[model samples]
Target chain A: MAAKVDHAQFRLVIPSQTRYLNLVTGLAKRASLVAGLDDATAAKVSIAVDEAVTNVILHAYRGEGEHSVELELRFTEQALEIHIWHTGQGIRSDQLVLPDPKEYIKHPRKGGLGLLLMSRFMDEVQFKADEVSGRNECCLIKKIS
Target chain B: MADLSIAVRHIGDVAVILPAGFINAHTVREFEEALEGQVQQGRYKILLNCKDLNYISSAGLGAIMGLIETVRENDGDILLSNLQENVFAIFDTLGFTQLYRVFPEEDQALAAVAPERKA
Candidate 1:
């Protein structure tokens, strides 16, 4: 992975609002397509990136005030790597636990499915946060087929 | 910032909400409000025409899910139509396909909403 740092990286910083989520997802989709992805794969990258950034805007910033979410996409020969950065309340690992699809289907809830979709669409998902700096990063990687 | 805009139409007893733009956290509130208005008016049978919708995520799905029981309780249902392939994938990925009725065409969804009525 270290040797693959030669890949081009595109960074987009947008206001942490759900409306701006498309800007990030669009970038991810186009970045993936430019990196040699098929239409379906590009769509997956867009959806996954959309969900990740939405969580930051809704939960991290708690949907209030003005904040910025930076989305960086790196196109390596083998993968499309995405990183999202924000200064908001970072989620605990346990918070990512989602109910079984059957459970939600039986008794539908309005939440607890973002992480599931992200994990399902992307090949790799990771979270890193610094409590002191209040900065959190969500990393998503999808291997090129 | 892209906002979600909802257009309302009445096909007999059903309320057809034509949503345009992105449906996510920022816009789900407005989405819910639109549903709430319908729910308040006792218009429980609803159909969402997503032809102009550019995008959607879990937040938008959640909003739709939150209102299901209420609408069903009123002997009505909220069905979706004209889901772009990419948008439909999210629903399929999340197992919403089994929970909601998703159609390929707006007229098909509207027809499904009220089988007794004419388009």
Candidate 2:
């Protein structure tokens, strides 16, 4: 029997605070590299993961004290999938609108860029809400060929 | 959380901000304050040297967007230089290159805005 080196999974659970964002991104980058993504793609994956977790901290768990965000990285032969799970407000991907950077800078509002960056860097983004368990999950998938 | 330190140096009328470390949701406040401090002191001409900056998330980008309007309103602009390839890709993907001037070297960025300093 041979060890299945081509497929793996990693999970981390951290406090729902801004301070832990770097840790999540660090693991995302290293895991991406292990999944055979190029350096640039690894960086992009890290950015996408950062955005997703940031949204979870800011929007999902806003004003809620002492919660935890669960992040799982799944590396398959075809793609790298990152799933972020939290118990808070659910997010709808269809509702997101990407701002035009040229015009957006003139008005200068915070937020609305994270989703755009996530969607741009990741090949597929899926959102799921479990009304029964009251949990919301945002999964980011990056295809590796 | 990764540590971020900011040092500012004045070159004529421009204030050059050197940020070393990661700029994510956790560290964006320090970066924002470093930029905001210059504006409060009436130094609107800003230059961000990202030579030592390792990474930035949307939070950091928002901080830049938050301040650009005020800086430009006062007849000054926030310029960037020495971006790592990964950092530049993020800016380019979001079309920041269209709005902000990015130079390969600090001297080039400083020279590009020297005309404004003269006025």
DockQ of every candidate:
0.70, 0.69
For every candidate, C-alpha RMSD to the true structure in Å: 2.9, 2.7
lDDT of 1 by residue, B51-77 (tens): 898788888898888889999988999
Give residue B71's error in model 1 in angstroms.
0.7
* Candidate 2 lDDT score relative to the true structure: 0.89
In order of appearance, the predictions have TM-scores of 0.89, 0.92
| Candidate 1 CAPRI category | medium
Clash pairs for candidate 2: none
Candidate 2 lDDT over A110-133, as tens digits, reads 778888888889999989988899
Best by lDDT: 2
Q: Which lDDT values do the candidates have, in the order given?
A: 0.85, 0.89
| Steric overlap count per candidate | 0, 0
Q: Give the TM-score (vs. native) of candidate 2.
A: 0.92
Q: How accurate is candidate 1 locally (lDDT)?
A: 0.85
Q: What's the i-RMS of each model?
A: 1.5, 1.7
